[model samples]
Target: MSLSPQFLDELRSRITLSGVIGRSVKLMKAGREFKACCPFHNEKSPSFYVNDDKGFYHCFGCSAHGDAIRFLTEAKGLPFMDAVKELAQAAGIEVPASDPRSAQRQEIQATLYDVTAGAARWFEEQLSGIEGAEARTYVKKRGLDDKLVRAFGIGFAPDSRGKLKMALATHGHDKLIETGLLIQVDDKEPYDRFRGRLIIPIRDQRGRVIAFGGRIIGDGEPKYLNSPETPLFDKGRTLFNIDRAAPASRKSGRAIVVEGYMDVIALAKAGIDEAVAPLGTALTEQQMEKLWRLVDAPILCFDGDKAGQKAAVRAGERALPVLTVGKTLRFAMLPPGKDPDDIVGEGGSAAIEPFLAAPSPLVRVLYNSRLSEIDRSNPEDRAGLRHRLDDLAKSCTDKILQEEYRRSFTSLFFEDFGWKGRDRTVVGDAISRTRRDIKTYQSIARSALYGCFRFPQTLLRSLEDICKIDFDDDVLKIWREKIVDSVSARPFLRDDGVIAILEADMISPPQKFDITRDLRFSLNVSPEVGTARLTRIIRFLVENEALSKALDELNHRVINDTGMGNYVALEKMRADVRAKIKVIRDQEYESGATDAEADKEELGGAAGQSAASATA
Candidate 1:
């Protein structure tokens, strides 16, 4: 039975080669591909390589090569038919009964690839030909040598559209149009898509030219023109210089994502070859995922101006929710009004090494970007900063990570501005005095529970464990059960989502306490401080509950006259629980006093600074 070429192409594209190879081999991302020790042959250093976009795995050591199906047959020892069936299943493709049209379609697509390859060769010929004198001069002026130009497959698109159309006319106009070398419009003959521009062929992972990017030699409106989406090209999924950068990234252990093709070529000329650029678009999720596969965090190189800073922030925001623990982005900003190409032209690639060495982390860039946007003088402006930080924290879907970010931003806020407009002494004294009684700890735990509901983001990491804890207080237990049930039903509730759930159920706190008052107390405290305090209180409750259970078990043992060991152990456990309670309470008091003194000092310093400024 013959499979359709289109079906096989789709299957190859769908099955990420690294993932299939990774199952049996320990594949580590090297540049734009994954590398592992050859499963076919034993070796110390890894030589087996898998390029997912290219849909093939190769071993340099043994010269083994094939796609996913071949790997299954050769490595897994499956028969040819079985391997095809398995791969088809994994790729979500249904195998059809023998079809002859599949082979014809495959042949046509192969011819189109040939057509694009032929056009690329023609472009290169034009660059070195008499008509390319102007283009060659421009290339020399940019400092790219013959070897560098040839390495990047740099070519020249002639000014006349009909020139390329004439050269490849033998291949048929339909093939040229389909390959994006020629553009066809309604009621008009097809002309070249790229005219009078420096041609840079964009290749797939396998090093086959898939599309072309053209930069107009002189003043042009669009400046750069890329092939529109074709059967084999999607701008969002394509990155310039990726074919070379992927392998280079493995050696450098880094993939530097620059803003443009010029930056990529400039860096390469400067001996920094592990650089790629997005094709006339902001970095997309697919691009980031690809970059991550090559390196844990690809450094994003942006311009140093306001526009560049804004781009960095936007990229960070887009990456936040989907961010896993290890996967992230680093940012490199060139000097004011400068770019990678400009810097490399002036001082060489090593000049930009310093910026790359200390590229700001995603979190730092996110915070600093917001700070640059807002006014810091007025109280209202500062409040806006707080809200913005909170929103960014809430955007994180990972509960533990979200809580950590919330605390980090809160700490930064307090460190820079300190608490404002609220009486810290009064609030501290009230909490300190009220929390002295053991019963108050339970009340605080209950309030913390409500806080988790108020800000559902808080429940992300702790919800499940908190739900399982056995509570002696009837009212608090009821609240815990309600929260656990609600959260279990809708696990991803955020912001006012918890409140909406409660409102729908008409749930209210027990009449013994005012829910509003407790909520205000919890909400008023700085999130980091509140979290610490509540966490400690919860620990005390859990520890105390364990002690009580032990004492009860001892009593039953004594009633049955098991032994004096039960009574002695009970007394010792009781003392340990009391000591633990004392330690927690004392630590809380010390921390509270330290924070209060710090707040007062900050306020005094701010006042003094203001008075000095006024006098001056």
Candidate 2:
């Protein structure tokens, strides 16, 4: 079905590139752009970017790029027309009746992307001038080296009223504010929003600068001010360090998710480059999916304090359900009152290496932190802590892991309660209760209750991606194996099956507390989203039939002449484009539509004229 132009525009407007991208990838706000793992390819890190203002997407992993339609066409296998129609439907806009105007709007949007690019260049050049000396000194003082500053495209925004606004105007362009490069207080006058600060231009994976993050020099009230969610940037959906860390993560087979800029930089400096951080907020599940694509296991490292601990809990909860047998997670806590940066700063890479080396298991971290606060000195506290511990233990759907945890934890109680001297362990009774817990994979048995309504067949790939990998530690390995098996079994089961299987399962209080979170934030996904994704995959496979067939043939040929086969593949793709043009021409001919009738398409007057002459 064809979608109207208006509908397409609205759909484009309704879905921020950041949000759509953020759903699958974690993005940290870098200036106005969101950065995260390049979902287009496997990586151990993030280097993909989505620009809301510019309406562009790019990935550094395999150098893929284009607008949303292009992304759908490539990633989801939507024909350009189908993607537009779907987006239009989603946006609730009827496609524009006037195709010509719809076509014209495309050019206007294209011009906006160009204008943004031009403005970025101007900003970079200005930063090199004396006016930018202060910003330069500031970044340097903050411990960013010259190469790092340049790699981040560190520029300076002059403290002037509207130098940027005027510069754009002088260039015969006035769409600066539309790109969020500048802002206007009143309709009459506009000013650059990023002036007089150390500018960090945020780039998508293709490394095109889309937005800016500015850090003010010392004593400034707001030390760091990011660009307002402009047309091109959204803070909630961007991940910092995606540009540099994606490849590292891809290569290393893991991703390290940190808490802040300093933490990311400290890790990078210490040679642990597969780290990315959020844009000064709690790490969202939206961010975790991004990491999932790059590496099998994504390690969550937060500060050691209360807030950091809370963040870790949230991250753990979000990522656990997603964990599969091979895919795993570990948590790292910084020393009290210190961040990754603090450790690196105080003692260099050597000091912080141990923390990364000995990251904590998510289960242990979550349950342990909560357990410490309870006082066994009182009976109520003891009961409460037992309830908490019981709940937590129940969260593990793997009976073996649950059993192990119960046994291990029971031993701890014996030691803690000084029961090593006395006999008859009450906690030992809790261990027996735990034996029946997680006797079944609930999601697997209840296919109808696939959590989210949309689950995918290709999800098997994701299932394998997360579940099949083993970690160095035996405890973590065992824990992940159960998660993988439970989630993988979900696509085939009925809801009753799930209940029947899991009813036998019981969790200690601490495990229960974390288990719910694990379902929400961890590897567990909603069946609806998963199923929809699978539907899209089915559609894509059908749409790319010609290419798929050709690829099959080409793969056979590549075994004989690898280099020549690649050339042949390119040639075939080029031939396919030409074949499409020929088909379009024939269709227009059969329809008896003259060039004049379709002049509104704006595919260059030359094509129209040639077709007109041909018809004549």
The number of the candidate with the highest lDDT is 1
Residues 358-477, candidate 2, lDDT per residue (tens digit)? 888766776676568788688787667666666666666666656655655544554455433142243233223322221111222122122222233334434543333223345444
Indicate the residue-level lDDT of 258 in model 2. Answer: 83
TM-score of candidate 2 versus the correct structure, residues matched by position: 0.48
Listing every candidate in turn, what is its Cα RMSD in Å to the true structure after a full C-alpha superposition? 24.1, 31.3
Colliding residue pairs in candidate 1: 31-246, 31-250, 32-246
Every model's TM-score: 0.55, 0.48
Residue 4 accuracy (lDDT) in model 2: 60
- lDDT digits (tens) for residues 1-616 of candidate 1: 7667887777777777877777657889889988888876667999988988778888999899999988765565344665676677678776664657865665576687798899899999999999899999999999999999999999999889699999999999988898889989996999988888999999865467889999989998699999988877888988888778875675567889888889999999999988999888888888887788678898999888888777778888888787878888999877889999999898897799998888888877888877777777878988999999999988888887788778877756764565421333543343344334345445545666766655554454455546645655776676667666776677776636666666577766444657554542434565444444444445555665565566556546543332446446645655565676565455333355654554456446655876999999
**Candidate 2 regions off by >4 Å?**
1-116, 170-175, 184-188, 321-328, 386-616
Candidate 2 lDDT (Cα, whole model)?
Answer: 0.59
